[model samples]
Target: MFRLNRLTDYAVVVMARMANDGCKVRTAPQIAEDTGVPLPTVAKVLNALARDGLIVSQRGASGGYRLGAPPERITVAAIIQALEGPIALTACVDGQSGHCESESLCPMRGNWDRVNNAIRGALEGVTLEDMTAGLFVPMGERRSPAALQQASGK
Candidate 1:
């Protein structure tokens, strides 16, 4: 099964928390608390994200981190790339020279590239905004608990 490693999954959770919070700079501890990811893991994910230019870091008394760009401009593919490198399902599709062992006899060598590109394209279509769209209601649209229960036929 194609799956994201734990760190990549944590990174996405951390990023979603940030996107939900908007452009405000958030401390590592705050992010850890908000996302329920461990502080050390949050710090590690933040470092990788900042290094990849996904989030900007500041060093000072009031310093923290914020997204490098708007949520709508950042795609899921970019986040995956930032945390996990390229999204190649196999070595042959990675586009690196001389990395695969079966280059001589592999019939599915170039075919994997097509599959990889399709996956990448699908991920690129989803943005951070898309991921957190239904997480919260606007202030004007919020209803009381009773109203919510009634609306849901509870």
Candidate 2:
């Protein structure tokens, strides 16, 4: 059940679209049209991205939003964290106490830590430029050997 929320997915789509446009200043409507995202949602995502310093917003006529830094400098992890919070599979993995009273005695605590780190590292390996270049893989689209096992029916 691990998955990105709708807003985070939309944010990545918006950013990837912007990067595909050579990282130019794009109006919300333009991005909405290009990415098939709703106008209001695009506005909300843009505002969040700007507030996170991931993008810069311009006002007045002929103004729009553009990347605050080069696309190459922004990682997928940054985008997801901006839209969501820190990437942690479980609260305990992120230094937060779990609802389970026996969290202190959980046998899989270290395993969850390693799992969290592995997932974070995979996301950090992808940049906005990779997204723009169509080299980025969505969570469901990842095709590692372990993932392929499901299809192989092994």
Candidate 1: pairs in clash: none
Q: Report the C-alpha lDDT of model 1 over 14-106, residue by residue, as the tens digit.
A: 888899889899999999888889999999999999999999998899899999999999999999999999998988876655886778787
Q: Candidate 2: list runs displaced more than 4 Å.
A: 134-154
Shift in Å, residue 113, candidate 2: 1.6
Q: Who wins the TM-score comparison?
A: 1
For candidate 2, give the lDDT of residue 58: 91
TM-score of 1: 0.86
User: Candidate 1 overall Cα lDDT vs. reference?
Assistant: 0.87
Candidate 2, overall lDDT?
Answer: 0.85
TM-score of 2: 0.79
TM-scores, all candidates, are 0.86, 0.79
Each model's lDDT: 0.87, 0.85
